[model samples]
Target: MTAPTTMPKFSKENSERRRIAKQARRLSLRVLIVCGAAETEKQYLEGVKGLYRNPAVAVKIKTRDKSPLEVVRYAAAFSKSDKDDFDEVWAVFDVDEFDIAEAVREAAKSNVNVAVSNPCFEFWLLLHFVNRRGHLNSYKQANALLCKHLRDYDKAQLDFANFQDKIDIACARAKDIDETREKPYANPSSGMWRVIGQISPGSHA
Candidate 1:
Protein backbone atom coordinates (compact mmCIF):
# COMPACT_ATOMS: atom_id res chain seq x y z
CA MET A 1 0.00 0.00 0.00
CA THR A 2 1.22 3.55 -0.72
CA ALA A 3 1.81 5.98 2.10
CA PRO A 4 -1.35 7.75 3.40
CA THR A 5 -2.18 10.82 1.35
CA THR A 6 -3.16 14.10 3.00
CA MET A 7 -6.48 15.66 2.06
CA PRO A 8 -7.31 19.34 1.68
CA LYS A 9 -10.04 21.18 3.58
CA PHE A 10 -13.56 20.82 2.16
CA SER A 11 -14.07 22.97 -0.93
CA LYS A 12 -16.32 25.99 -0.52
CA GLU A 13 -18.78 24.56 -3.00
CA ASN A 14 -19.00 21.29 -1.06
CA SER A 15 -19.43 23.09 2.22
CA GLU A 16 -22.14 25.32 0.75
CA ARG A 17 -23.95 22.31 -0.67
CA ARG A 18 -23.89 20.65 2.74
CA ARG A 19 -25.24 23.79 4.33
CA ILE A 20 -28.12 23.96 1.89
CA ALA A 21 -28.87 20.29 2.33
CA LYS A 22 -28.91 20.66 6.09
CA GLN A 23 -31.35 23.55 5.83
CA ALA A 24 -33.62 21.55 3.55
CA ARG A 25 -33.56 18.64 5.94
CA ARG A 26 -34.38 20.90 8.85
CA LEU A 27 -37.39 22.43 7.06
CA SER A 28 -38.76 19.21 5.64
CA LEU A 29 -40.80 18.25 8.65
CA ARG A 30 -44.13 19.73 9.80
CA VAL A 31 -46.66 19.25 12.63
CA LEU A 32 -50.42 19.26 13.10
CA ILE A 33 -52.53 21.29 15.55
CA VAL A 34 -56.07 20.59 16.73
CA CYS A 35 -58.70 23.16 17.56
CA GLY A 36 -61.86 23.07 19.66
CA ALA A 37 -65.27 23.66 18.15
CA ALA A 38 -68.88 22.58 18.06
CA GLU A 39 -70.10 19.25 16.64
CA THR A 40 -71.06 20.95 13.40
CA GLU A 41 -67.56 22.43 13.25
CA LYS A 42 -65.77 19.28 12.18
CA GLN A 43 -65.49 20.85 8.77
CA TYR A 44 -62.89 23.21 10.19
CA LEU A 45 -60.68 20.29 11.17
CA GLU A 46 -61.07 18.62 7.80
CA GLY A 47 -60.40 21.81 5.94
CA VAL A 48 -57.10 22.38 7.74
CA LYS A 49 -56.04 18.77 7.28
CA GLY A 50 -56.80 18.81 3.59
CA LEU A 51 -54.62 21.83 2.95
CA TYR A 52 -51.68 20.49 4.92
CA ARG A 53 -50.36 17.01 4.11
CA ASN A 54 -46.69 16.24 4.49
CA PRO A 55 -45.11 12.94 5.51
CA ALA A 56 -42.62 14.55 7.89
CA VAL A 57 -45.35 16.55 9.57
CA ALA A 58 -46.41 15.98 13.18
CA VAL A 59 -49.91 16.56 14.50
CA LYS A 60 -51.18 18.23 17.67
CA ILE A 61 -54.82 17.71 16.82
CA LYS A 62 -57.44 18.53 19.45
CA THR A 63 -60.87 17.04 18.89
CA ARG A 64 -63.82 19.33 19.34
CA ASP A 65 -67.63 19.09 19.65
CA LYS A 66 -68.62 16.16 21.89
CA SER A 67 -65.35 16.15 23.79
CA PRO A 68 -63.60 19.43 23.25
CA LEU A 69 -62.70 19.96 26.90
CA GLU A 70 -61.95 16.31 27.44
CA VAL A 71 -59.63 16.24 24.47
CA VAL A 72 -57.75 19.25 25.86
CA ARG A 73 -57.47 17.60 29.23
CA TYR A 74 -56.22 14.28 27.84
CA ALA A 75 -54.86 14.45 24.31
CA ALA A 76 -51.26 13.79 25.20
CA ALA A 77 -49.50 10.42 25.00
CA PHE A 78 -49.20 8.65 28.34
CA SER A 79 -46.90 5.98 29.75
CA LYS A 80 -48.24 2.90 31.47
CA SER A 81 -45.22 0.61 31.90
CA ASP A 82 -42.94 0.77 34.99
CA LYS A 83 -44.25 4.25 35.63
CA ASP A 84 -42.15 5.33 32.72
CA ASP A 85 -42.86 7.05 29.46
CA PHE A 86 -40.49 8.73 27.08
CA ASP A 87 -43.11 9.46 24.50
CA GLU A 88 -43.46 12.77 22.68
CA VAL A 89 -45.81 15.60 23.53
CA TRP A 90 -47.11 17.71 20.67
CA ALA A 91 -49.62 20.53 21.22
CA VAL A 92 -49.77 24.12 22.48
CA PHE A 93 -52.31 26.80 23.31
CA ASP A 94 -52.40 30.57 23.91
CA VAL A 95 -53.91 33.12 26.23
CA ASP A 96 -55.56 36.42 25.42
CA GLU A 97 -56.27 39.52 27.50
CA PHE A 98 -59.88 38.58 27.93
CA ASP A 99 -58.88 34.99 28.51
CA ILE A 100 -57.92 36.42 31.88
CA ALA A 101 -61.63 36.84 32.52
CA GLU A 102 -62.72 36.10 36.09
CA ALA A 103 -63.93 32.64 35.17
CA VAL A 104 -60.67 31.46 33.58
CA ARG A 105 -58.29 33.96 35.22
CA GLU A 106 -56.51 31.63 37.59
CA ALA A 107 -55.97 29.11 34.85
CA ALA A 108 -54.64 31.78 32.53
CA LYS A 109 -52.24 33.06 35.17
CA SER A 110 -50.42 29.77 35.16
CA ASN A 111 -49.13 30.79 31.73
CA VAL A 112 -49.57 27.24 30.67
CA ASN A 113 -48.82 26.67 27.03
CA VAL A 114 -52.46 26.82 26.06
CA ALA A 115 -53.61 26.50 22.49
CA VAL A 116 -53.74 29.81 20.64
CA SER A 117 -57.35 29.36 19.67
CA ASN A 118 -58.89 29.28 23.08
CA PRO A 119 -62.11 31.21 23.83
CA CYS A 120 -62.81 32.98 20.49
CA PHE A 121 -59.89 31.59 18.55
CA GLU A 122 -62.36 28.95 17.44
CA PHE A 123 -64.57 31.55 15.77
CA TRP A 124 -61.69 32.76 13.62
CA LEU A 125 -61.16 29.13 12.69
CA LEU A 126 -64.77 28.87 11.53
CA LEU A 127 -65.12 32.15 9.67
CA HIS A 128 -61.77 32.82 7.99
CA PHE A 129 -59.05 30.25 8.58
CA VAL A 130 -61.32 27.53 7.13
CA ASN A 131 -60.24 28.86 3.75
CA ARG A 132 -56.56 29.61 3.60
CA ARG A 133 -57.04 32.27 0.94
CA GLY A 134 -60.26 33.93 1.93
CA HIS A 135 -61.43 36.97 3.87
CA LEU A 136 -64.49 37.28 6.12
CA ASN A 137 -65.55 40.73 7.23
CA SER A 138 -67.10 41.22 10.65
CA TYR A 139 -69.91 43.66 9.93
CA LYS A 140 -73.00 42.62 7.98
CA GLN A 141 -73.27 46.09 6.52
CA ALA A 142 -69.63 45.91 5.48
CA ASN A 143 -70.30 42.61 3.80
CA ALA A 144 -73.11 44.23 1.81
CA LEU A 145 -71.15 47.35 1.02
CA LEU A 146 -68.27 45.17 -0.02
CA CYS A 147 -70.38 42.92 -2.24
CA LYS A 148 -68.02 43.70 -5.05
CA HIS A 149 -65.37 41.81 -3.06
CA LEU A 150 -67.35 38.57 -3.06
CA ARG A 151 -67.08 36.63 -6.27
CA ASP A 152 -69.77 34.06 -5.42
CA TYR A 153 -72.39 36.54 -6.69
CA ASP A 154 -76.04 37.17 -5.81
CA LYS A 155 -77.58 37.25 -2.29
CA ALA A 156 -79.04 33.75 -2.73
CA GLN A 157 -75.75 32.11 -3.67
CA LEU A 158 -73.55 33.68 -0.99
CA ASP A 159 -72.60 31.92 2.24
CA PHE A 160 -75.18 33.82 4.27
CA ALA A 161 -78.51 34.77 2.81
CA ASN A 162 -79.29 38.47 2.43
CA PHE A 163 -75.87 38.80 4.01
CA GLN A 164 -75.67 42.54 4.55
CA ASP A 165 -79.33 43.30 3.95
CA LYS A 166 -80.21 41.19 6.97
CA ILE A 167 -77.58 42.98 9.01
CA ASP A 168 -79.14 46.33 8.19
CA ILE A 169 -82.35 44.96 9.63
CA ALA A 170 -80.95 44.25 13.08
CA CYS A 171 -78.79 46.26 15.43
CA ALA A 172 -75.37 44.74 16.16
CA ARG A 173 -76.34 41.90 13.85
CA ALA A 174 -72.93 42.15 12.24
CA LYS A 175 -71.02 42.66 15.45
CA ASP A 176 -67.90 40.58 15.71
CA ILE A 177 -67.62 39.88 19.41
CA ASP A 178 -64.40 38.00 18.92
CA GLU A 179 -62.81 40.62 16.74
CA THR A 180 -61.10 42.07 19.79
CA ARG A 181 -59.82 38.62 20.66
CA GLU A 182 -58.55 37.85 17.17
CA LYS A 183 -54.87 38.62 17.63
CA PRO A 184 -52.67 36.68 15.25
CA TYR A 185 -49.41 35.35 16.60
CA ALA A 186 -46.29 35.46 14.49
CA ASN A 187 -45.66 32.50 12.24
CA PRO A 188 -42.36 30.66 12.34
CA SER A 189 -41.17 32.38 9.20
CA SER A 190 -42.00 35.82 10.57
CA GLY A 191 -39.62 35.62 13.52
CA MET A 192 -41.87 37.76 15.72
CA TRP A 193 -43.35 35.35 18.18
CA ARG A 194 -43.61 35.94 21.91
CA VAL A 195 -46.52 33.53 21.79
CA ILE A 196 -47.53 29.89 22.20
CA GLY A 197 -50.57 29.51 19.96
CA GLN A 198 -49.29 27.36 17.15
CA ILE A 199 -48.43 23.86 18.32
CA SER A 200 -45.88 21.83 16.44
CA PRO A 201 -43.77 18.99 17.76
CA GLY A 202 -40.10 20.02 17.70
CA SER A 203 -41.00 23.26 16.02
CA HIS A 204 -40.23 26.87 16.91
CA ALA A 205 -43.76 28.15 16.19
Candidate 2:
Protein backbone atom coordinates (compact mmCIF):
# COMPACT_ATOMS: atom_id res chain seq x y z
CA MET A 1 0.00 0.00 0.00
CA THR A 2 1.12 3.55 -0.79
CA ALA A 3 0.31 6.69 1.08
CA PRO A 4 -0.93 9.79 -0.77
CA THR A 5 1.05 13.00 -0.53
CA THR A 6 -0.49 16.37 0.14
CA MET A 7 0.17 19.34 -2.08
CA PRO A 8 1.85 22.41 -0.62
CA LYS A 9 -0.29 25.47 -0.16
CA PHE A 10 0.53 28.52 -2.29
CA SER A 11 1.70 31.53 -0.33
CA LYS A 12 0.97 34.90 -1.85
CA GLU A 13 3.64 36.55 0.31
CA ASN A 14 6.26 34.14 -0.93
CA SER A 15 5.08 34.52 -4.49
CA GLU A 16 5.37 38.29 -4.25
CA ARG A 17 8.82 38.04 -2.74
CA ARG A 18 9.97 35.69 -5.49
CA ARG A 19 8.48 37.95 -8.12
CA ILE A 20 10.40 40.91 -6.73
CA ALA A 21 13.58 38.89 -6.62
CA LYS A 22 13.04 37.77 -10.20
CA GLN A 23 12.54 41.36 -11.23
CA ALA A 24 15.73 42.40 -9.49
CA ARG A 25 17.74 39.77 -11.34
CA ARG A 26 16.69 41.47 -14.58
CA LEU A 27 14.92 38.34 -15.68
CA SER A 28 11.91 38.30 -17.92
CA LEU A 29 8.65 39.43 -16.39
CA ARG A 30 6.65 36.24 -16.73
CA VAL A 31 3.14 36.76 -18.06
CA LEU A 32 0.47 34.13 -18.68
CA ILE A 33 -2.18 35.18 -21.19
CA VAL A 34 -5.29 33.04 -21.48
CA CYS A 35 -7.37 33.70 -24.58
CA GLY A 36 -10.93 32.75 -25.50
CA ALA A 37 -10.08 31.57 -29.01
CA ALA A 38 -7.27 29.61 -30.61
CA GLU A 39 -5.58 32.05 -32.97
CA THR A 40 -6.09 35.81 -33.14
CA GLU A 41 -5.08 36.88 -29.63
CA LYS A 42 -2.37 34.26 -29.50
CA GLN A 43 -0.79 35.43 -32.77
CA TYR A 44 -1.06 39.08 -31.78
CA LEU A 45 0.74 38.56 -28.49
CA GLU A 46 3.34 36.43 -30.19
CA GLY A 47 4.00 39.29 -32.57
CA VAL A 48 4.28 41.71 -29.67
CA LYS A 49 6.87 39.46 -28.11
CA GLY A 50 8.77 39.20 -31.38
CA LEU A 51 8.69 42.95 -31.88
CA TYR A 52 10.09 43.72 -28.47
CA ARG A 53 12.42 40.74 -28.23
CA ASN A 54 13.30 42.11 -24.84
CA PRO A 55 15.16 40.03 -22.32
CA ALA A 56 13.07 41.63 -19.56
CA VAL A 57 9.70 40.41 -20.78
CA ALA A 58 8.23 37.00 -21.56
CA VAL A 59 4.66 36.25 -22.64
CA LYS A 60 3.05 32.83 -22.73
CA ILE A 61 -0.38 32.47 -24.35
CA LYS A 62 -2.96 29.71 -23.98
CA THR A 63 -6.36 29.34 -25.60
CA ARG A 64 -9.73 28.04 -24.45
CA ASP A 65 -13.06 27.31 -26.11
CA LYS A 66 -15.99 29.73 -26.67
CA SER A 67 -16.77 31.05 -23.21
CA PRO A 68 -15.12 34.20 -21.89
CA LEU A 69 -16.08 33.12 -18.38
CA GLU A 70 -14.34 29.79 -18.86
CA VAL A 71 -11.20 31.57 -20.04
CA VAL A 72 -11.26 33.70 -16.85
CA ARG A 73 -11.79 30.60 -14.74
CA TYR A 74 -8.80 28.96 -16.39
CA ALA A 75 -6.68 32.03 -15.77
CA ALA A 76 -7.61 31.95 -12.09
CA ALA A 77 -6.68 28.30 -11.80
CA PHE A 78 -3.45 28.68 -13.80
CA SER A 79 -2.24 31.51 -11.58
CA LYS A 80 -2.45 29.31 -8.49
CA SER A 81 -0.98 26.18 -10.02
CA ASP A 82 2.22 24.94 -8.38
CA LYS A 83 3.96 24.11 -11.64
CA ASP A 84 4.05 27.71 -12.82
CA ASP A 85 5.37 30.92 -11.33
CA PHE A 86 4.08 33.97 -13.15
CA ASP A 87 4.21 37.68 -12.33
CA GLU A 88 0.79 38.27 -13.89
CA VAL A 89 -2.06 36.44 -15.63
CA TRP A 90 -4.54 37.97 -18.05
CA ALA A 91 -7.70 36.66 -19.67
CA VAL A 92 -8.30 38.00 -23.19
CA PHE A 93 -11.98 37.94 -24.09
CA ASP A 94 -14.56 39.73 -26.22
CA VAL A 95 -17.85 41.30 -25.16
CA ASP A 96 -20.28 39.64 -27.48
CA GLU A 97 -23.35 37.77 -26.24
CA PHE A 98 -21.60 36.67 -23.05
CA ASP A 99 -22.08 38.74 -19.91
CA ILE A 100 -18.54 39.41 -18.66
CA ALA A 101 -19.40 40.80 -15.22
CA GLU A 102 -19.07 37.45 -13.48
CA ALA A 103 -15.80 36.72 -15.21
CA VAL A 104 -14.46 40.13 -14.24
CA ARG A 105 -15.59 39.61 -10.65
CA GLU A 106 -14.00 36.18 -10.43
CA ALA A 107 -10.75 37.47 -11.96
CA ALA A 108 -10.65 40.26 -9.40
CA LYS A 109 -11.17 37.79 -6.57
CA SER A 110 -8.36 35.59 -7.91
CA ASN A 111 -5.93 38.37 -8.80
CA VAL A 112 -6.28 37.62 -12.50
CA ASN A 113 -6.52 40.46 -15.01
CA VAL A 114 -8.76 40.73 -18.06
CA ALA A 115 -8.22 42.47 -21.43
CA VAL A 116 -11.63 42.64 -23.00
CA SER A 117 -12.86 44.00 -26.33
CA ASN A 118 -16.35 45.12 -27.16
CA PRO A 119 -17.79 43.39 -30.28
CA CYS A 120 -14.53 41.46 -30.90
CA PHE A 121 -10.75 41.61 -30.80
CA GLU A 122 -10.58 42.36 -34.54
CA PHE A 123 -11.92 45.80 -33.71
CA TRP A 124 -8.87 46.34 -31.55
CA LEU A 125 -6.69 45.37 -34.51
CA LEU A 126 -8.72 47.65 -36.72
CA LEU A 127 -7.83 50.53 -34.45
CA HIS A 128 -4.28 50.23 -35.76
CA PHE A 129 -5.48 51.09 -39.24
CA VAL A 130 -8.57 53.23 -38.78
CA ASN A 131 -9.82 55.64 -36.16
CA ARG A 132 -13.29 54.18 -36.08
CA ARG A 133 -15.94 56.72 -34.97
CA GLY A 134 -19.00 54.49 -34.68
CA HIS A 135 -20.29 51.33 -33.08
CA LEU A 136 -19.44 47.86 -34.38
CA ASN A 137 -22.22 45.49 -33.39
CA SER A 138 -20.67 42.17 -34.38
CA TYR A 139 -17.36 40.43 -35.06
CA LYS A 140 -18.26 40.09 -38.72
CA GLN A 141 -18.90 43.80 -38.99
CA ALA A 142 -15.54 44.54 -37.42
CA ASN A 143 -13.87 41.94 -39.62
CA ALA A 144 -15.35 43.47 -42.73
CA LEU A 145 -13.83 46.83 -41.93
CA LEU A 146 -10.50 45.21 -41.10
CA CYS A 147 -10.61 43.25 -44.35
CA LYS A 148 -10.58 46.46 -46.31
CA HIS A 149 -7.11 47.18 -44.97
CA LEU A 150 -5.84 43.66 -44.58
CA ARG A 151 -7.29 42.28 -47.78
CA ASP A 152 -6.24 38.70 -47.09
CA TYR A 153 -6.70 38.64 -43.34
CA ASP A 154 -8.02 35.48 -41.81
CA LYS A 155 -8.80 34.71 -38.17
CA ALA A 156 -6.18 31.97 -38.15
CA GLN A 157 -3.45 34.41 -39.03
CA LEU A 158 -2.22 36.96 -36.47
CA ASP A 159 -0.70 39.31 -39.11
CA PHE A 160 0.52 41.58 -36.36
CA ALA A 161 3.68 42.30 -38.30
CA ASN A 162 1.63 44.42 -40.68
CA PHE A 163 0.35 46.58 -37.81
CA GLN A 164 3.51 46.77 -35.73
CA ASP A 165 4.40 50.22 -36.98
CA LYS A 166 1.00 51.61 -36.06
CA ILE A 167 0.82 50.28 -32.50
CA ASP A 168 1.09 53.73 -30.96
CA ILE A 169 -1.74 54.94 -33.14
CA ALA A 170 -3.86 51.97 -32.10
CA CYS A 171 -3.06 52.59 -28.45
CA ALA A 172 -3.99 56.25 -28.72
CA ARG A 173 -7.17 55.50 -30.62
CA ALA A 174 -8.21 52.81 -28.18
CA LYS A 175 -7.60 55.23 -25.35
CA ASP A 176 -9.70 57.88 -27.02
CA ILE A 177 -12.58 55.49 -27.63
CA ASP A 178 -12.46 54.21 -24.08
CA GLU A 179 -12.47 57.73 -22.73
CA THR A 180 -15.40 58.90 -24.85
CA ARG A 181 -17.70 55.89 -24.64
CA GLU A 182 -20.18 54.82 -21.96
CA LYS A 183 -19.58 51.83 -19.74
CA PRO A 184 -20.66 48.31 -20.81
CA TYR A 185 -21.85 49.77 -24.11
CA ALA A 186 -18.56 51.03 -25.42
CA ASN A 187 -18.65 49.51 -28.86
CA PRO A 188 -15.34 49.11 -30.68
CA SER A 189 -13.46 49.39 -27.40
CA SER A 190 -10.63 47.36 -25.95
CA GLY A 191 -8.56 47.20 -22.77
CA MET A 192 -5.73 45.39 -24.60
CA TRP A 193 -3.42 48.38 -24.75
CA ARG A 194 -3.10 48.47 -20.98
CA VAL A 195 -1.81 44.91 -20.92
CA ILE A 196 0.28 45.50 -24.04
CA GLY A 197 1.95 48.47 -22.41
CA GLN A 198 2.79 46.39 -19.40
CA ILE A 199 4.13 43.54 -21.50
CA SER A 200 6.34 45.85 -23.51
CA PRO A 201 7.39 48.36 -20.92
CA GLY A 202 9.46 51.29 -22.24
CA SER A 203 8.87 50.11 -25.80
CA HIS A 204 6.24 52.38 -27.31
CA ALA A 205 5.51 49.97 -30.13
Best candidate according to lDDT: 2
Model 1: ten consecutive residues of lowest lDDT: 186-195
User: What TM-score goes with each of the models?
Assistant: 0.31, 0.82
Write one digit per residue (lDDT tens) for candidate 2, span 23-121.
Answer: 754566778898898888888888887887766666778888668889998987877783557888999999887888888888888888888998899
Model 1 stretches astray by more than 4 angstroms:
1-34, 38-42, 60-71, 76-112, 116-122, 125-205
Residue 45 accuracy (lDDT) in model 1: 33
Give the per-residue lDDT digits (tens) of candidate 1, residues 1-205.
9998998777999999999976755655333333334331234333333443332443334443323333334333221121222123222332222332332232243222333332223223232212221232322432343444445433223343323232222212112232322443311011101111122123332
* Model 2 lDDT at residue 128: 91
- Top TM-score: which candidate number? 2
lDDT of 2 at 155: 89
Residue 61 CA displacement from its true place in model 2, Å = 1.3
